[model samples]
Target: MNRRSLIKAAGKAGAGALAVTALGGAMARAASTEPRAASAKPRIHVGSDPGIGRWSHAKSTSHEAGWTDQFQGMCTDGTYWYAVSNEGDNQRLHKLTLDFSSTVASLSAPRGSDHIGAPTFDPQRRQIYVPIEGPEPELIWKVSTGLSTVGIVPLAGRTPGSPAPQRWKCPWIALNPSDGLVYSSVFGDPERNDLDKYVDRVWAYDRDTGLLKKEIRLPSKVYAVQGGTFGNGGRNLYLASDYEEAGNERKHVYAYDFSAARDGSAVRSWGKVAIPDADDEVECVVFAHLTWRNARDTHITVGILDDGVFSGSTDNVYFRHLAVPSPGLI
Candidate 1:
């Protein structure tokens, strides 16, 4: 639990900048310790992430196409930036502008549950909440990402259709930009092995009163979810790592205080936060959604997208910048 900076990449980060590299003291406390440590812990030399205080970016140089891969579920409309590409069979859904270009609406998923996890954007209810993952009865669409704005209306009572068999897993998207309230977590299928299936759901809705308002029921099964702002003023909800094996799982990150939920389905926790995989700690590990950049109200950035595949990692997907060694707190 001792970390100020931690991001790593063994080698080959797609070959395009963001090479991040740094490790301070005791090798940044033994690269974040955890290799089942029977002993020996100091080597330090994590990866990327260096400037958010102490860990900005190592030598990686921020390239690897600036970290872009099938990466699904991500939102930002401050001026541009939106994702839902996990690319896997070519699944698409796009919007970008922070210089990434390519806009005019992407959306390309007609089957396979269309994946695309927790993505939000409401700017006064202009609407743009994508929650696709079909296989069962789990489906959320809500469109008009932009172009609609009257007395204030958009996305009402599921009708975009397409529902049946979606066992939503790894889904994450939390937004409370004042009263947007869209926290979600109903996850399962960490990477995929299917252990009979056991995942407790977590939810909260009210983009404008589709009204479902938090309904958490957990014993486990929750890989990622983030939302926090104003420090202690009015928001903070994060929970990741719910345990799973083989198929990959285990990272652990928790923090709740959504006003202590008075009915949105009880959620009150002011502790437990983990994501330090010093070593051997890589099994469907989760931490790729914590973006609240610049200086908007405060600081809250936590994103980890290392598509560098691993096992030898070198298919490409690195460059979220580099050098992120530390107490393993991804």
Candidate 2:
């Protein structure tokens, strides 16, 4: 199966059953199987302002699939969103550079079609870490400028009934410059059990030990998980989906405020970032978003995901400017 099929399968499956508890696909099962330990702490606030305000999708003369969390990708400057797509017919990381308008650029991954599911940039090293799914031989490729292959790591096995590597693939990646650690989310196969859920957990990989240091579970499993810095040398990880929480029918952004989760640690439900209302419904949908930052601060450009005059699904990539409060506004 391909990425599109994986998403469609998720919608037809436990998606309905999750309406009661508000979780879907592999993530829902992971949440129920491993309940969160009580967070004695108060609800932490990760940002002074949090909301996507009025961003309509922007049609890039060059790219499509704007501002979506569906891919294992991150925004570069908080000014533009980019992704590595191995989706059917589409291959390569879709790059958009947004200024007054958006322009698309293509950077082919070192490997073939094994869809690029996760990507995080190490600005210091000028390197990009991307996870692969469904390639002839499964592996994750570390590509740098000139798209050099700096390192190659074999990923864990896929889940059974996992929808053929596309419908329900696992995404694992986390890099915080300040923490000096990488966190990866891993899952079991999708076909082995009748139950739809999977074992989803985050692990800290120490560069030296080569052994995962800490294993921490989340309040729930998040299919489109991405982590980055929020300006203060603190790590801000956000998970999104129109349907990704248990006991809550509404879509939500699970913000893990790990300003303090260094030294092999974990953070919890710090806050929620709301998904903007789409005129149409989206499913099993994995999307890549663009980013821009004045400096250390990072946020998506407005309307990069909104459908426009483009019509039909073609509207997936477009951006319209909206009034959003920022620290500058504060």
Candidate 3:
């Protein structure tokens, strides 16, 4: 769809910041229809404190710092976490120890890598796949473990010579180690910032061939998917939303059966968890069992695009232990 058409679609859908205000009752009703495990209870709680492991970027306005956090993307290799930020002048990748206690290294994206979105890491291939978003956003820049640009992967839906009407922005990418396939969320409202009007879908692509295999249409309630990841060895898929209800700032996270999605079936909402926090613009989430020796003791680490326009603090990263669901339920 063209930019004009996209704006018209959003208007027809009544998607705007004001429209979200009325979604509370609608969202609750939508949640009630979701099928859940017989024994599933609310996984994430608010009053309790977050996880034990924590990290901070320490609000920095210095030009050399690149950017504190601008729609950041993150993934971990059990020991180190790779964070990618879209700094207008100097896009950078920061590798930090899992504990968020120390910076292992910092690398800059090659020139013209403008507006890099969230990325997925391939441990087997030792590569990081980053989505480059711009006026024409379809390229997935491949960076080696040594932080070198190996090549670029064009999105199947928006190939180089294709019409721009059908083009989509890849906001986040996730790798399923079980099948070694890459998954990404694509959607946009064109000129409008109203996420509700955007057409949303989840796509699965072959990492090696860059071939598009399947596309799953997301539910309307899911306005924007900012980040995603596979859990339980690719048995389940988790996606986090971008926009939230103004007052509460509680963004919903959806879980889907990855196996079903891989087989070309409509992703069923296995369950949903809400993250209640002060940050209204929750960008992405990745689950890693960094602390415990047992793999089952996994926890979720959330990233916030701290613009300092909303919340004063520029700390963009957070760890939520209580937000993690029971292993038995996932």
**Which one wins on lDDT?**
3
Instruction: TM-score each candidate.
Output: 0.25, 0.56, 0.68
State each model's CA lDDT, in order.
Answer: 0.35, 0.37, 0.51
Candidate 3 structure quality by residue, lDDT tens digits, 1-330: 111233364332110010000000110001112211123222422222231112221111111133345536576554455677664465677776444445667777656653566777776776777766555535667877566778887666434345223244566677776677777755443345654345456677776556666676654446556678766456566777655645656666666665545444565556556664625455666654323322223345455554544443333443333324343333
State the local distance difference test value for candidate 3.
0.51
Model 2 — which ten-residue stretch has the worst lDDT?
A: 16-25
* Ranking of all candidate structures by their TM-score, best first: 3, 2, 1
Choose the strongest candidate by TM-score: 3
The TM-score of predicted model 3 comes to: 0.68
Per-residue CA lDDT of model 1 for 1-330, tens digit only, reads 000011012110010000001111111011221112112222322221212223333211111332145443345544444555544466555665533424555656456643445355555554556555434444445555552222211222233322212223325544554455654543443433452133344555555544455465543444323211111112444443323333434344444555445443554454443333312111121122222222111112233444445443322322122222232332
Full-model lDDT, candidate 2: 0.37
Q: Give candidate 1 misplaced runs (Cα > 4 Å).
A: 1-64, 67-72, 75-81, 84-94, 97-118, 122-124, 127-171, 174-181, 185-213, 224-304, 307-330
Ranking by lDDT: 3, 2, 1
